[model samples]
Target: MENYHLTHEDGKYKLTKENGERASKVFESNKDEAIKSSKDFIQNQGGGSLKIHKNDGGFQEERTYPRANDPKKSKG
Candidate 1:
């Protein structure tokens, strides 16, 4: 599954998937709603990671869906 990223830009919230350069979805002045939708999209795609970024390109937070769905696993 491709990764999803939520970012705040141009006074709007945008959700972008790894496969595309343009935003896959955009929210009008609502970061919370955009984030929720981004997570739902990743979860629907059989699980993936979501990364939230600040306006200045700083890392905010990351969430991984369903541990089992992560492609990389640590050796026990």
Candidate 2:
């Protein structure tokens, strides 16, 4: 499975693949746009996980796309 992270670096908000040193995509606007873009990209890529960070560089939330019909995470 592909893992991606959205973070702010070099004055730009970027979406970078896990362990990648370079950004896969940079959002010139804001984190929200990057999030939307990441979601669509992940879905098209057959579902994956996205880790999003806030503007201040803090952990925000995570999203997991469904390649299957069931949720991949446990509630407990």
* Index of the highest-TM-score prediction: 2
Q: How close is candidate 2 to the true structure, as a TM-score?
A: 0.79
- Where does the lowest 10-residue lDDT sum fall in candidate 1? 67-76
Please, what are the lDDT tens digits per residue for candidate 2 over residues 1-76?
7889999887788988999998888888776777888888888888888889887889988778763633547551
TM-score of each: 0.73, 0.79
* lDDT value, residue 76 of candidate 1: 29
CA shift at 29, candidate 2, in angstroms?
A: 1.8
Residue 17 error for model 1, in Å?
1.5
Give the range of the ten consecutive residues with the poorest summed lDDT in model 2: 67-76
Residue-level lDDT of model 1, residues 1-76, one tens digit each, is: 5688888888887888767789978888566777778777777778888889987878897777765765566342
Off by over 4 Å in 2: 67-76
What lDDT score is found at residue 52 in candidate 1?
93
